[model samples]
Target: MAEETVSCPVKIHMTTEIFQEETEKIELVLFGHYYEKGGSAYLKYEEMQEAGKIHTVVKVASGRALVMRSGAVSMRLDLREGSRRPGTYENGYGQFPIEAAADEIVHTRTGSLSGQLSLGYRLYMHGDSVGTYKMKIHYEEVQAAK
Candidate 1:
């Protein structure tokens, strides 16, 4: 059977924690679009930072996820349980090699229009460990106004 594609406006709440010398936390609430196609779910959104605007796409499959960013900052992160994936990161200044070793990846679908994804991984830059990071994303489709 062929899977049907579905799309809708969504509100996303994201929290990221980095554990290095110290703990750092970042949170964001964003409005974006959520879609499912070809057996994968995708969330597309844009973020504004000091440098410029960055577009991000998060794709989640059965046991892995891919995060792609463009614009001001560009990177592609491939995350899977118990595996290390090589990728690259680039900004205005230069580009560098990066990798992610995912310790855990959990994706749960609460409903037809809502879901959550949690990832725990170690980040590396230039073959050096940067930190251990955990990212949680909760997204739900926006309801139409009455």
Candidate 2:
């Protein structure tokens, strides 16, 4: 038997916290599509910010995750526990070197269509430590109306 790709509309709730001089928290609710292929799961969503619209994609595997964003703000983040990944961030102004050192990455599935992902990492920009950050995402499939 071959594994088939499964795709569905999903609703996502995300919370992010940054620990710098002070802790800052941000939350967002987004609607998108969730799909599973091979042995990996992926989430695709769009976010509207003051800058403009940003498209985001997240891929979760065994012990690692990849996040990619494009539009007004663009960046690719590869997070793996106990390792530092180098990437770049670009916006209206310019592009800057960025890196992420992941301390923890936990992904849990409550059901076939519902799960949660949590990440704890340290962010560096321009070779300088920016801050420690925690991000949590919960996603569930949307049911079609009868």
TM-score of 2: 0.94
- Clashes (backbone N, CA, C under 3 Å), per candidate, total 0, 0
Q: In model 2, what are the clashing residue pairs, if there are any?
A: none
The parts of candidate 2 lying over 4 Å away from their true place are: 1-4
lDDT of 2 by residue, 1-146 (tens): 54648888999999999999999999999999988887888889999999999999998898898899999999999999999999889999999889999987888988888899898889999788999999999999999889
C-alpha lDDT (0 to 100) for residue 97 of candidate 2:
85
TM-score of each: 0.94, 0.94
Candidate 2: C-alpha lDDT: 0.92
In model 1, the runs with Cα more than 4 Å from the true position are 1-4
Error of 1 at 129 (Å): 0.4
- Over the stretch 1-146, how does candidate 1's per-residue lDDT look in tens digits? 65658888899999999999999999999988889888988989999999899999999898898999999999999998888999889999899999999987888989888899898899999889999999999999998789
